[model samples]
Target: MSATSVPRARRRSAAPPSVDGWELFAPGIRGEGTAARRAWRSRYVRQSAILDAAAAAIAGFAGYYLWFVVFAAYGPRPPLWAVLVFPVVWVPVMLVARAYEERFLWIGVEEYRRVLNAAVLVLALVATVSWGLRLDVARGLVVVTLPLATLLTVSGRLAHRHWLRRARQRGEHLQTTILVGSRETVAALDEQLQRTPEQGYKVIGCCLPSRERSTGADAFNGLPVLGGVTDVVDVVHRFEVDTVAVLPGPEIHGSVLRRLGWQLEDTDAELLLAPAVTDVVGPRVHIRPVAGLPLLHMERPELTGVRRWTKELVDRSAAAMGLLLLSPVLLAIAVAVCLDSRGPVFFRQERVGRCGETFTMLKFRSMVQGAPKLVEDLTRADEGNGVLFKMRHDPRVTRVGRTLRRYSLDELPQLINVLRGDMSLVGPRPPLAKEVEKYGLDMHRRFLVKPGLTGLWQVSGRSDLSWDDSVRIDVRYVENWSLTFDVMILWKTVGAVLRGSGAY
Candidate 1:
């Protein structure tokens, strides 16, 4: 049945009750819709305040004891009032820094960044006051307390986030969302929200433009098509939506958006507009108001300069230290590989690196000596996403090889590559020469940075990712490379390796 042929009554029934009736009869429904979200937000904020206060208190007391009691001879004793008042001051400082804002809570790196910024501000204020007043402030106490507080606060937030994620996974705490856009844009936004359920967006339905609405189709991408764009306010009231996400498109322009915002003013649902740009977030994009209009200003990615040099220095230093510290484990893996297989303990394969340069990537030999030769015979059994060859249980894997691969012990030799500048501590996965040969134009963007010992690809399902997904992640990492991002991936890599999923 075509959309035009659909009965008028059926279309009206598909939409919510008339706006006037819903408003007059269901005034209390608005409060019920937002109660859960408001409650969750309040609870989270309260918990965060408690955690921050406790962290500050612990650091303050511990620092005072260590400085005045243990190292009493080295510095003048500070007054006990300073220690007692630290938590009182710290929580307000965090509030001033916007650390506990609802927007920053439970998601994104911004929360952690705000916490760190607040800690720094507190330390600076303390140091300046002490110096200006000529007070006998113990340098040791100042040094230890601020850092300890920051660490404790961040740790607490991380644990809280983990708990929240578990809750979201169980469908306990989630924003009831209604997506408004063209079907294509709605589906895309829905897919992303579905992909990261921990972000806490639970899309209940979508509102499409009248022209975009299908005739007989009542659902799209498994979500019901609630109504047309004009029906958004009624749909929100009827469904008790906590969030209404509008995707940018021709049908929903400035005037239409303004009207929608005005209509939602009396309701509890928050409005969110998703710009067309994708995979570009954080500091790269900023909103600049010019000529009374807010315009998005995107800065070019910084692929080089002081930050890049700093990253290189940190990578080399970390790689050198890691190689030194893990020498025993490396030795053990080497011995095991040698005893279990006739091949050399190390496997060196030519891999494409930064700027399409070639390097010999090293790994503990986890396959038979003649495994490369067997590729043709086993092509039919390839389990990879086409670009790479992967087999969960290959015949070529030695007894010890399976264990090494499972735990990613075989990749330990890549530390030498990192130290040698052939790779980074975290970067795009190094592509094999054959894999690079099959690359399209955009895929070459992966070579913009050095390959990694472990990267977004490594931690994000590794071999289980489709070829397109692998490429997309690599390019995203290249375009948004940051020291913090590298650290995040490295941290997640530890957990991924322990879980041992998708690491054949």
Candidate 2:
């Protein structure tokens, strides 16, 4: 062979050619540093600080007042040293409880639980110390302080919560988040955020993971697609993203995911995982380390023994007491319905109850005498779907019926259903026989327990919720059934009824 025809051994390139190519494109790509971006970043920072200070101030004041109570009851207040040290202990406890976390600050049971636990611990320690020191402390002082501190601190947080909620309504101080996922998943998530922007996540852009390059013009609900999955890290940096939600998808690999997590370290942006479990509650998920791998254990929700008895007792007691306490209201409603329409004071409907058992569920009549048969005539005009039949403004509704439905007073007679053991104070809302007939297999799982007078559906968004969302909430409640959760739902139910939120 000629010398010119002989091939020379080639040396490897010092760096990958891809790196050089990327370098050329890097400077031309713009990131999230526009004026709106800077404003959003600053607003979140300011909000965080304000909320933190609010938490600290409330906690501190509570601690001091509690100390004062014990001091006053003992005939002489504690020395300045004890008073100063009291708030010190409270601050750490509050921080540990993450009372400063924004999500728990507004009308959540978490905040109250933390506050109560911390207060009880602090007071218990003080009592022990007083006994050890032989300092005379009166019980009244402790008792008085408990109520005083709890009242003041809770009231303060509530006031702050109101202010923050109003601020959100005016479109001030919200976290700008970038969702990274497949086109379909991100699009669905973007829809939720768009509908409820007041929940406080502003979608800046979508980082869609596609096999092919995504045009920056591609949009989900009008939000731009900044780049494809391969450009996620770059997009994060470019967008100055406060939060990155890795929504449900199979495109991301474990190694690539770990790399993404590593890249997020020390960045101001928060990394959130939106696992594919659509109807799971937080309490049911437990993580345990096994053989160097973190495994999540999901406990089956079973109501038996104490839990069953507790629920039954709660149902009976609450129903009995409610019937007695609301007797006057019931009487008034009965009179109003009688005077406003020809319908009976009470309406009786065949409903599917526990374990697919059919029973008569009683409620104060909220419509004209023969409304059920009218449902057939209105089928084409039905504003609801699947098992629900809702009309925002139904013609069959009497003047009194509208008021009764709006405040949920019509459902008060379900207390009788609870007494008969066909219903619960809290569970899935009872379904009509016709509705139950349409149940798919998964839908029947709701009947494992007795139907409820009020439930996750009632407390969440009631008539306003879509069938899917309602079913998801019910499934979550059933899967994560706990006494604590039941208590919380009942508490929320009160607020829902009072606010007339998601009612007729």
Q: Which candidate gets the maximum lDDT versus the true structure?
A: 1
After TM-score superposition, the amount by which residue 486's alpha carbon in candidate 2 deviates from its true location, in angstroms, is 2.7
The global C-alpha lDDT for each of the candidates, from Candidate 1 onward, is 0.84, 0.70
When summed lDDT is taken over every stretch of 10 residues in candidate 1, the lowest stretch is 3-12
- For candidate 1, list the clashing residue pairs, or say none: 3-215
TM-score of each: 0.88, 0.79
Instruction: Name the runs in model 2 displaced over 4 angstroms.
Output: 1-89, 92-117, 124-140, 146-151, 158-162, 191-198, 212-217, 220-223
Model 1 regions more than 4 Å off: 1-32, 74-82, 120-140
Q: What is the lDDT of residue 372 in candidate 2?
A: 86
In Å, residue 472's CA in model 1 sits off its true spot by 2.0
Considering every candidate listed, which one attains the maximal TM-score? Answer: 1
For residues 83-155, write the lDDT of model 2, one tens digit per residue.
Answer: 3443456556666766555556554467777767767776777689888999776455456545565555566
